[model samples]
Target: MLDQVKDAAREIADARRKIAAMGPNFDEEILGATRALYAPLIRKPSAAVKVTADVAYGSDPRQKLDVYQPAGAAEHVLVYIPGGGFVAGDKNLDGVFYVNLGNYFASHGILTIVANYRLAPAHAWPAGAQDVAGAVAWARANAKSFGGDPARIVLFGQSAGSTHAATYLFDPTFHPAGQAGVAAGILMSGPYLFQGELRPNLKAYFGDDPSRYAERSPLTHVGKSRTPLLLSVAEYDPAFLAAPTYELARAVTLRDGKSPSVAYFAGHNHVSTVMSFGTPQDDVGARVREFIASVG
Candidate 1:
């Protein structure tokens, strides 16, 4: 046991070094390296948490979700949207990623939903938000059947997924019957405002119409929405993504007359914010659990 403990400590130390060495870049190389670091460390899903995979939320093939059902009754349900740069991402990436995320929350007695939305260039713009609406709709209708409270559903999105969740929460155009339809929202490392030079991925999703960028941005609509929000940015997030977290928080504070709950994860990059879910170095997971508890 002593030897095992030492080995685990050494592994964690190595991971910290690797993550720190990688800096705050948001490229495939960094993302892939981060995944490689965490994959081996993440334990398999607990048997106590039952997973129902590839459940359809909408007609589109991409509009599917996976549910992680806790062993006991759950008071709140979490709808998780993953980030894939608006071009490519899924409910399960390389198998371990979101599965670990779903398991982590469900194990804590929160029924978890990991969802996939249609990608950009093929689907584009409101499609991701629309898919988020569909998934939330599905959760609201079916949550009771899965021992979860429909009225206590929360939206959690990371990166591009966070952008979609913010759009769904803030933009009335995507809301069902002019209703936000969610109790609370959690956004991590999202680009709320689309200012300055557009990235290739953003252009693919929002198109070449620079003039419409403000109208399409969630930050533009944030001042009007009254939904409770928890925003977070990693210490090592890329500038484009990190800047908007503060921007959205400021918008929320101005709207609500108080600062919204916000978190800054030290020593983590954009990808590691989610990748660290089921590992020992999971500060983000603890914060998320606390947020859900407070909201639920």
Candidate 2:
């Protein structure tokens, strides 16, 4: 046991050292590379589905989304949003991730829309939120045209994307244009509170506005919710995320909101959770699929 412990510690330390060496520019480079590398993979979706890229979703800058359609008609659609701490991430880069996830849901007869929202520093809190809302609106509006059921739209996101998804569903100004509201949401490792100095990096985007945090926090907005919610948090993510997910789930439950559900994925970390989206039988994927089926 001691020997195994030592070996594991050494491996962790080595991985940390390599990560540290990657430096501040690593995320930017990785962001660019990941997208370019995955673009081709996205173009070739599974044979069971039809894939479309760069569909005009919103106007101008936010007007981009990738749509995945199953061979057969679908009664439900899931809009998938990716995560990158709200700093630097794009849907084009996440094409492969969404493709596989779409394939999974498509196999289960659900169309999927992978949306790209404006990132922060250039575009702040509500900008990305608005972009996501626009994409959802597009999906809902064109669901029938795409052979999907508009009444069964589901919002799915991970990490920062989860944060955006939660806020959009809960945010008063973010509801789909002229639509009643979404049916359900699946949030994985999302932060429910940003009023304080919880995350320094997040401050650049959310800012120090107490009112914004209060109004924007999903936990605070759950009372008026008209949709069922499934909040899943990885057990090993940062406390800033994990703790808030637990607290928000409790608060929503206490508020008598749609019997909100909660789950913690064991043996999974933050990055691993979202990256495991379409992987078969993985902890995060299994929980997400189960939640989707229940909500469907």
Candidate 3:
């Protein structure tokens, strides 16, 4: 047991050294590397919500959702999109990612939908956007089966999932149309506006065509969006993730009848900002609940 503890400590120190060596620009990579260690350390809350798994929203195998229904009848629903920089992420982890996010909110009485979308490289930019919108449409059509209120549905997104959620809601071209009937949104640590310095794998996820960037970027479409938005950034997040959230909040407040909120998660980094959802460490989850309830 002592040796195991010592080895884990060494691994943590090694992860920190890598972060120091690579700098904040590699925040996503550093977060991914440390997540296997940190994610398991955080305990999973006992299941208080009933789960319905692998409900299909699209023909693709990845286009599926896990619905978390509260103990009592639900009055609101949240469609959660997990993050993996548009390329890698899953809706379920033993105690991390969307599983924790879905369980926490559903346990709080909001019927939560955690959905998987097609990944990048093999499936790029707009594919993520399309999948998210499809999930929202599915949730809207199927909310009542789980005793949820469709009119009060909110979209909660983290990391790349935030980008897809914003795109589905904000972009004029989207099919399910994020702005049509969705009540609110919570977008956290998304690299929506800037993709200028992305690594090769990420760039491939967004596509090789630089010319399509402005055409496909969510930052360009926020002016047309009217959804009540809560934008969050972590204090220790990389500059690329933190800066645009501030800019977006400023833009959101300018629009008439749009109530926008912004928060900085202190002492948390990109992944932990979202991973802390079901734990006592959660600070942003409270804000998200407040935002959705206020809108309802």
Candidate 4:
């Protein structure tokens, strides 16, 4: 057993070292290259939970969601939006990671919904927000059917999904469908404030004009949001992301009204932090659960 532990430790250390060596867009690059390799490695939880499959929220095929209901009645609802830099990502990618993530939460008595949204280049900013809103509406109206509370809904997103969810919460005009509400938000590893460094793909979502970048950023409106936020960054995250994360947090802190809860995940990079859900090393998940409990 000790030898197995040692071997696992060495593998994680090696992975981190390689990730650090691969600079710009390292998180996206590394994960893209290794999804097939990681797929077989993830083990689903032993807990039994009821699940409702592939429910549509929007006309787009991508805007579908899978809802998981806990064994018992759930009062707190979690809506998960994935990140793909506004270009790629699905609820079932790299061995159905999000499905397992949803199950883990459901097993713990949190009604969880794993949502999908339209990707950029084909569809842009407001489109993603609209899909998210549609999903929120579906959850709110149907929460009672799944034994979940409609009032305690949390919006959770990572990377580009963060941009969309944050926009929905911060921007005054992007109302969610059916007047559904978001009680709290979890923003992780998002490039909310950075300018002039967007990669080629980001143009699809943010647009071509460099001068208009600020208009696309949530930083400009994050302070306007009254909902409590938990903003986090990985310890080994790139400099660009690290800076904006703290910048956003500081901005929220300086706000006259409610402030954001902040955290930094030690020994993790942008990818690892989100990928750590349901594992023995579930520090990030614990943080998320604690944050949810505090608000829910």
Order the candidate numbers by TM-score, best to worst.
1, 4, 3, 2
Model 4: CA > 4 A from native: 1-29, 32-41, 176-180, 257-259
Q: Any runs in candidate 2 off by more than 4 Å, and if so which?
A: 1-45, 176-180, 198-200, 257-259
lDDT of each: 0.90, 0.70, 0.78, 0.78
- Model 2 lDDT vs. the true structure? 0.70
| Model 3 regions lying over 4 Å from their true place | 1-29, 32-44, 175-179, 195-198, 257-259
TM-score computed on alpha carbons, candidate 3:
0.85
Candidate 4: global Cα-lDDT? 0.78
Whichever of 1 and 4 has more lDDT, that candidate is 1
The Cα RMSD of model 4 versus the native structure comes to 3.0
- Candidates by lDDT, descending order: 1, 3, 4, 2
Residue lDDT tens for model 3, 219-250: 88888877778889876678877887887777
Model 2 per-residue lDDT tens digits across residues 134-228: 88889878988889888888898887888888888876678845443677988888787777564555876787676677876767776666678
| Candidate with the greatest TM-score versus the true structure | 1
Per-residue error at 194 for model 1, in Å?
Answer: 1.2
Superposed Cα deviation of residue 47, candidate 1 (Å): 0.6
TM-scores, in order shown? 0.96, 0.80, 0.85, 0.88
